[model samples]
Target: MESFSGPDATTSDDGPPPPSPRARSAEARRDAILTAAATAFVEHGYGATSVDDIAERLGVSKPTLYYHVGGKQELLGASFTLALDAYSDAVEDEAVSGVTGRERLHQVVQKYVEITTTVHGRCLHRVPDVELTPEVRDRLRAVKRKVDARIRDLLREGVRDGSLRSADIRMSTFAISGAMNSIAQWYAPSGKLSPEEIAERLWDSFAEGLRPR
Candidate 1:
């Protein structure tokens, strides 16, 4: 038997075909729905923002919104997942950069500041944990724990390498993370300080505190 190729098919040299117009259209609409959902949740809190509110914000009928992205619960979950994944990935990536632990921690701080200040990042803290199902909340908690462990590990590495001061790692971790996480609470896009500036300013304070005597 011989294999036959259709007119639309390509040889092995060609990369995978691009997404079909319909698939692209559907993806764009789904993104729009997610954006509207995130904005509503951030602005009004999850409990007060219903699926109907998201649908109205998107200017799409409830059925259309459901067809694209399911209900309010799913949208909220997706938004949280997006924000958390970004934060986790940023930390893990910096952890493996073959640099001093203090340097890597510096990088992680900046990334955290920039990501948490975004619209999606705000979703991570804006919506209360009670709004999520037990399963979702548990899974998110695990991710956060993993990130926290990585930060602690980096602190240890800094101590061993003599790049950071000898101190209570747990208290230091708490102080560093607690302060950085609070940025989402008061961050304003139009604020005088840019994320980079804010990151630098915060890092300066942290670096001084962690410096070797």
Candidate 2:
């Protein structure tokens, strides 16, 4: 019978071990900081929120917060990007479902509204500003343009299928996007109408003129 010399006897040399529990805990702390920063930014707006405020919200030291994020601007950028990603995912998911062009368009719009009224939505609109560095501004603009292009593509499809009327797709896209994106301003789940109701009303008003009559 062969005897094993040790655990290493059967193991080939490989890279270092996985991240330790401490490292994982650190990562979790970083995520907590980002989440806290996002909530603070949304509740108070970018101009009013400070790194110290975020750190306090997370109950962490300023140095610990800095260890995770470089500074307030980086935190803002991360928050905005997170929100944009959610919005884009909602639109893309609805768009991919096989449905009538009109139905798909309305579904996409509804999803947009739903996402924009959430915490993420509030951060996206309130974080960007003149104070952002050029890099952050460019990143924000690029994300916005991507979302716009997606809306324009859907609207063009609706027009081609005759489910929507002829209109300036560009302006129409902008209008619809702007309307839904503004939900962070006044929308509350406790408000007079539910998110679904708001979406229906918006679709009814906008599609009324566009629907084939």
Candidate 3:
């Protein structure tokens, strides 16, 4: 089976000092803040959710919050980053290390589904141009476009191997993406379905239609 390494562990640590006890605490706090912020962003519109709202959610003072992410825009941007990282972690995985295009793409869909259902995924999808600074908006768009490209590339690879049907790559992407993104709108954690089950079901449904006729 193929294995993928994340950016942090993918490299050997250089000469940097081990994080101090304070640094570790700070890191943990930052993660907590980001998680809280992402949840707030998903629950409330990015424009409507204030820094104070996130601080309140985490039960931290504004100064403590600022120490982690600085402000709302940064928090919003970081939430998007969290989503992107999830994508890379999933799509980049070895996926039983399949060599065929369809095999690999199925794994991508599965992982993407699993990732999207989480807090990070919703944050990734929910951010909007109206709420973000122009620069941040553009940055998030770039990240999203890159994700789209990754999907297209996998599809094209599949087609080349005769494992996938030939289709309009761009429209195909929109169709698949629209279906996947809708998961966030209606999914419930309390529902009987688990993330793995949902991802597998989605892959089964999508794979049948996506194959060459």
The best-first sequence of candidates by lDDT reads: 1, 3, 2
In candidate 2, which residue ranges exceed 4 Å CA deviation?
Answer: 1-27, 93-95, 189-197
Candidate 1 TM-score to native:
0.88
- For each candidate in turn, give its C-alpha RMSD to the true structure in angstroms: 4.8, 7.3, 6.6
Q: Which segments of candidate 1 are over 4 A away from where they belong?
A: 1-15, 93-98
The model with the greater TM-score, 1 or 2, is: 1
Using TM-score as the measure, the top candidate is: 1
TM-score of model 3 relative to the true fold?
0.82
TM-score of each: 0.88, 0.77, 0.82
lDDT of 2 by residue, 26-86 (tens): 7777677778887887778788988889888877788887777769888877766677677
What does candidate 2 score on TM? 0.77
lDDT of 3 by residue, 1-213 (tens): 112334433334566455555657777788898999988988887878888898888887998877777788888777777777677566554542588778887877887888888887877776665666677677767766766787888889889998998568888888777888888876766889988998888888778888788
Query: Each model's number of backbone clashes?
Result: 0, 0, 0
Better lDDT candidate (1, 3): 1
Better of 1 and 3 by TM-score: 1
